[model samples]
Target: MEQESFRERRQAQAMGIDLPLGNSPADIRRRMEAIEFLLERSIQIPGTKYAIGLDAVIGLLPVVGDLIAAAMGSFIIWEAKRLGLPRWKLWRMVGNIALDTTLGAVPLAGDAFDLLFRSNSRNLRIVKRHLDKHHPETQIIEG
Candidate 1:
């Protein structure tokens, strides 16, 4: 399946090596596009124009909100680690989330920072590109 293979390509890219992966730049593009929808509001989800976004949905939890958000954001670092990203860079990535989580505790101000920072989505993209480069064998499989 393409979904499983996506990780493969991502892994390949992170290593700075070439693999037998085929092309489906669309998948990559789609992911980036999805981040927009995921990280922010885009015309709203129809019935919920004023619906809570990652920033708002996440903000409502107060202290718990930032903790959960930061934890979820840590997935990027986890993914990077899976792709064997350099330790220094990986640490820096974690630091980004830490910073975001810390600063995102200012109530309304923190939510604003979440929207502006969007570090989780940004880091995911960065790691994906890095992984894709080394392991281009992201052949979409169908069953």
Candidate 2:
């Protein structure tokens, strides 16, 4: 069963498809966590405790960078919607993305803000809270 699922997932990837059929709560949690990592904490600065991800790195490219970051951030909201999150929660997530994109568009200050704000991580937290309450089975016990 696992092999078949893996094969189907691979086939979907090969065809540039992202099927929603396989999006169980656990799957959504994993996807959201991976995205949060990529956008907010994928890299650690050498010899320092600070970390940054593609969101911060790409957000250095002026207008285009902020736009790309906003788009990536939108994916988290998309996944949350899949879980039937409340409208208010979705709006809150959208607001975070808007704030990040708007403020992060302000040249140097924006880049600095992107590094600190971590909107994706915020969205992930919101999703995690909802999932924990409504989908406890998806909770992963990290040791």
Candidate 3:
């Protein structure tokens, strides 16, 4: 019976409809890590100790850059919500995205802020903490 249930859950997830309580911790952790990688440290700065990703590059556009970045950041929050995070944490994530978007709207400063702030990475950390506290069994240890 348990095996059948697990199979059903997996099928649901495969169809892109993640069950609220059916996702394994490992799956969640993996998804969050992927998001962090895409949003934060996908590329290394030459001759510098900094890394960035699409978030920074997209934020380089004049007017629409910040908006695109914020939209991408929203995906992290959406995943957190799907994980059943509390309202407070969800709002905090939104606030982080909002701040990132607002400050990132500046001409040159916003682009720099996108590199420094890394709102998607910040949101990923929040999701990790919530998972660690609430679903420790799903935590994946990285070497």
Listed in order, each prediction's TM-score against the native is: 0.59, 0.86, 0.80
State the C-alpha lDDT per candidate: 0.62, 0.90, 0.81
lDDT of 2 at 141: 99
Off by over 4 Å in 3: 1-22
lDDT of 1 by residue, 37-140 (tens): 44444335567544334644675578798887777666557656766778877877888778888888888888777766766666765665665676555333
Winner on lDDT between 1 and 3 is: 3
Query: Whole-model lDDT for model 3 versus the true structure?
Result: 0.81
What does candidate 3's lDDT look like per residue over 44-142, in tens digits?
899998888888988889769889878877988887888899999999999999999999899998888888897888888899899989988887677
Clashes in candidate 2: how many? 0
Q: Better model by lDDT, 1 or 2?
A: 2
Per-residue lDDT of 39 in model 2: 83
Residue 74, model 2: lDDT of 94
Q: Candidate 2 at residue 121, lDDT?
A: 95
| lDDT of candidate 2 over 1-143, digit per residue (tens) | 88887887787667544433457999888878877887898788999999899999999999899999899889999999999999999999999999999999999999999988989999999999999999999999989
Poorest 10 consecutive residues by lDDT, candidate 1: 17-26
Model 3 lDDT at residue 53: 87
Global lDDT of model 2: 0.90
TM-score of 3: 0.80
> How many collisions per candidate?
15, 0, 0
